[model samples]
Target: MLKKVISKTIQLPDNRVITIETGKLATQANGSVLIRMGNTMLLAAVVAKEAPEEGGFSFLPLSVDYQEKFAASGKIPGGFLKREGRLGDHEVLIARLVDRAIRPLFPKRFNSEIQINISLISADETILPDALAALAASSALSVSSIPFNGPISEVRVARVNGTFLINPSPSLLEQADINLIVAASDSSILMVEGAMSEVGEADMIAAIRYAHDAIKLQCQVQKELMEAVGVEKTIGTTHHASAIVCYPIALREAIYADLYAVAKQHIPSKALRKEAFMAVSNRYREQLAKDQNGQEVTTTQQKEWLDELENQAIRALILNENVRLDGRLLDQIRPIESEIDYLPSAHGSALFTRGETQSLTTVTLGSKFDEQIIDRAMEDGYNRFMLHYNFPGFSTGEVKPNRGPSRREIGHGNLAMRALKAVLPPDKENLYTIRVVSDILESNGSSSMATVCAGSLALMDAGILVKAAVSGIAMGMITDPTTGRFAVLSDILGDEDRIGDMDFKVTGTYQGITACQMDMKVAGISYAMLEKALHQAKEGRLHILEKMAETIAAPRLDSKPHAPKIVTIEVEKEMIGAIIGPGGKVIQEIQKETFTNIDIAEQGYKGIVTIFAGNQEMLEKAVSRIKTITARPVMGEIYKGKVKSVLNYGAFVEFMPGKDGFLHVSEVRLERIENLEDVLEVGEELQVKLIGIEPKTGKYRLSRKVLLAPDVVAAGG
Candidate 1:
């Protein structure tokens, strides 16, 4: 039965429209939505494949992809390898963004394989595919049978001339000093990624609120779509809440009372608080063990009893005493120490330590060929500037195998990458490939933000003419005791992050924000709180930037001596074969002799050669060889030559660039010579003069004997 459904589409100022169609598409899935804004469109379908089998779900497998086809972009794939085959970094990142926004809304027991594919049928530069993908996924989940506790919306916010511009175009974004992407549910924010100058916390929060306000209509449109086409609600099976074990309430109260008093008198260190909590837990355990009723308890029962006691102690400490594990004011930021130019070999390097969290970021510059290439189903190939975050087990005081990057690492890296992407120089202006690697030396909370701060300083130190200097700060909020009142902290510690309601990270330059990200542990935050957090974060970010600038004010104008030297050469299509030789023999000989790395484009007209030697001497040698191989002879040029073969009338002399010219005896010299060998031998070097050119053929007529003396020529004859 085809049901006619009403769809709503709201047009925004930035040439973007939010559309929701109800009665059409993917009725069987938990939720589905087809979103179209401008020429950019995506059909996002959300379906949960399966529920958790045995253990509780620890991870959410959410996939988000932005597929770009040649047809959509009005261009075909440009290589001999025609079809798009693999997912690029951008696709992986967009997938991560949607996953982060939606994963938090699912119940822990609903650990199912949830897949959301954002298929791009058309593309418009203004309406960002990423933000559209988020809306589509949210709408699909809201209408689907899959249990999603969301109808979220996202927006791209930019600051141009100190004014917040929502969903700015690509060109407008280029002109704007700050670009921030924010995704929020009705009440709380879910995701943020963008870059700015060193912007204040107050402004950062304002930007978030602005984005929330801007996208409210889109969220409503999604809701209307669900009302129109959403499937019938499936009754979700609820799990029974765990039973709370009985313990001595009086004894637990007394222990917590004493511990609270001690904590109040002396701000206990993290280790001290942990030890004191453990001692109280052990005492309660002993009391249970010595119960005189002869009641034997199982291990599980004992653990439950201990867990209850621990929860009580923690809850009492927070609710009654209003004190944290590590004593600090509710809004107080952690101490920070930032230093740049720490690595001698790297182009730029910085070490940023905020409280216990520390990130060592390094930047590397390379040729255009070094840019990342991404290929996936929906999108063809594209290049990217990348950021990679690494978290070793030692960063958290644990011992684990040293392996490749985890999904968390990828997620963190992508977040930082997105934040900085707005400020990265365009490909045409800066041809150098950029790679920023953030290594977490220690982590407490928001190490990803620490990575951003360090990365910015490293970029500046490396002398990359970035649009602006960027710094990031992590903001945390602790709600008030009675009301939902909260205090936003600048730099949060590990415990604060665990207990806090929000982990908001803002990165940008002094002029404004470049990137911002926010995640919540509780329900969404109010606009006022977000404002306060941003205001406070700005102050903290500026302080960190000041410290960073003291070490390295700007990126060094020159690259490191150890860095690779790249030289690009353009050769004619016909001459490419000659330089490459048959089966690449000629190119191989050049590499072996010069010890350089040479990469030739598949098109055969352009080549990029990288020399990693200690000095320019090796680079010059390699360039000279390439020039010789690809060089062509110019008309009306003189050269020193050697005669290879002689005829009665003329002698064949090697002259010009990679060519041989014929010297006739009549024009060999002023006086005629009896034999060609009399004046020039097979193994002799002689100065040759070009006198005439053959128009039909490219061969040149040279006179070697013309410059010889008459007496010398006659004597030789």
Candidate 2:
């Protein structure tokens, strides 16, 4: 009844197996596949519709959405909605990985609207499915009767204690130094995204190669299943170019010559070079309407092909002449100029300008009240460190209305955040909520990497003792599909990145790579070429780090004058009730009297106390009050205790906070007292020593006679 449940399984190098099955569910879609690994299961269903009825878009209309079902994790959804509403940042990010991997494999002219939806139907706590979501989505599209050039799969490569592990469990990831998610076709890597612990270039590259081996085998499994299913993949007829795209023979020839000439020309200013290239494109567009046939109804996409030709022209020059668009050596980085404390009022600020790209970054430190609250699927908590990146249209000389941050902005910001997070001072060492904002004032290429560089400086300027200065570089690669000759370009430009086959962003410090992202458009690149790129990236990264050092060598000795100061103390857990009285009255009163923030938490047998204030006076005031509340009564300690009440035989003395002791009438004086009223009265003061405690009752014994001179007690008797 279920079509026998066709399935194929591949054993991972780590001894874990992934089973992909079809024909049991969602058969109406163009393609559907269920991927299982260690009890984790994800369902990917892809459907395509013919071109939109009245389309405003000419390019491929593709959408990828990923959702995590709480039911799959054996948990009920939280919040008032009692169900998942919008996609969280993590889900959106996962969807982006899949979109980037498969978007390029589709035929350029396949304008049919396509949608891929992936859901985690069964979530295994031990096995993370975010990395596997991409693989499942691609497998679905691969086995379907769709003209996709992929049965690609992605693998998570983690280096734990110097050994590479594929698809490591959550617990094993705790020890990994290098982590990467690599998506690949049979022979070529399609997409790459990962973070590292500043491992060397060689290690990072080796990790990639290791990941591809697993990916290749998975691809083979999908191919076999596709063959066994015997589904005929669709083969769309090759669409011809429109008349407008078919530029005149004379004009096309002239444009090619012009582009080659332009690429060879030595232009230092990015704006001037961009103008030179656009001038040729404008001239060709002007000639398109000169024909009497009236092809003014040309789709925007057709005219865009002319731009593609320009890209090709640039690529040809890069491959043939080993010449970059900027006229720098293949390994040369653009000149970098950086300065700290650029903003007068910012807690910490820096402006980093690398050739054409610029970032004005600022850092702000606050108390726990400023921490960001997370309300997401997997976890809901607070974040003490946050980084935000912004790119305005005017930054790149574009004219468009500003709305909100695009997906690219969010993704880049997240990358930079992780790059610097590894080096931040631990919360216990310095407790302050941190926020870094990078505003792109000018951009040509690698603004995100520029953000990383600027963020490090800003943090140092704010006196944050980061482990080491962090720097980033974006590497570009141009390959000749014919002879397989490839050139890895360092510090690439906008034009080079547009034409290049790969944009590999590598970021870190002198130690190793902190983060990396690689996305390739070609079928595949060889290990030799990839290795060269990594080494070159390292050279560029080190060069940038040296430049950053010239601006700020290390964190300053002090925060700015206006920054808030934090003080912390620990106390016995039993004393917590005294600090936070009934109805939180004591803590509230302390805050009011000192104008400071007090946060308390119980950790096992001890309680953590944190005091945040803007001035020395307030900070000291809060610390003293909390100390008094948590201090314990010590033996033989003299206290000017007040007589709380007088009794027939003794007086009650109020001592250390929340502690009281009995001062016996006989002990009140050296000579025996005839009446208690004659020696002591309520609301009186006396210097007493805590000499002993009743073993059974736990009542402290106070002595005032021990402090009296011996002659005075003898004369009184």
Clashing residue pairs in all predictions, respectively, total 40, 3
Writing each residue's lDDT as its tens digit, candidate 1 over 1-717 gives: 975655788778655556766546666656666777767767777666655445423345556665656566776665697866565556666776776677778764455667777777777766667767777788777777777777787778888888788777777777776577788887677777666555555666677778888777777777776766645656353331223334456765676565555445434345565677567656666665533345555455565545544544444455455555566554555677888778898877889887778999999877655677754434445465889999999988889897777667887887788667767777645656789999999988789988887888888777676776667778877665466545666677665676566788877677766667677765467777777777777787777778667767766776666765655666666666766778988778877887676666535455444333334677788778777767766655557888888888888888743467888888777776788667667867777877777888978888755556677467762
Per-candidate Cα RMSD to the true structure, in Å, reads 5.9, 3.2
lDDT, residue 240, model 1: 17
lDDT, candidate 2, residue 234? Answer: 72
The lDDT for every candidate, in the order shown, is: 0.69, 0.84
**How accurate locally is residue 708 in candidate 1, as Cα lDDT from 0 to 100?**
64
Q: What is residue 446's positional error in candidate 2, in angstroms?
A: 0.7
Evaluated with TM-score, which candidate comes out highest? Answer: 2
Q: Residue 189 in model 1: shift from native, Å?
A: 4.4
- Compared with the true structure, what per-residue lDDT tens digits does model 2 show for residues 1-717? 547568999999757889999988899899999999987999999988733435434567789999988888777777798898877767877888888888888865666678999999887878989879888988899778778888788889999988999988889998898888888888887878888887888788788889999988988999888887887867342343442345467866787898778878868887898789878767667666443454453545445666677778888887887777778888999999999999978889999999999999999988898888875545558999999899998899998687777778878898899899878888888798999999999999999999999999999999998999999999999887788788899988877788788888989989998998887766666778778888899899999999999999999988887777787899999888999988999899999999999999998989999889987778888999999988878888888899998888899998776679999887888887888887777888788889899889889999888878577558761
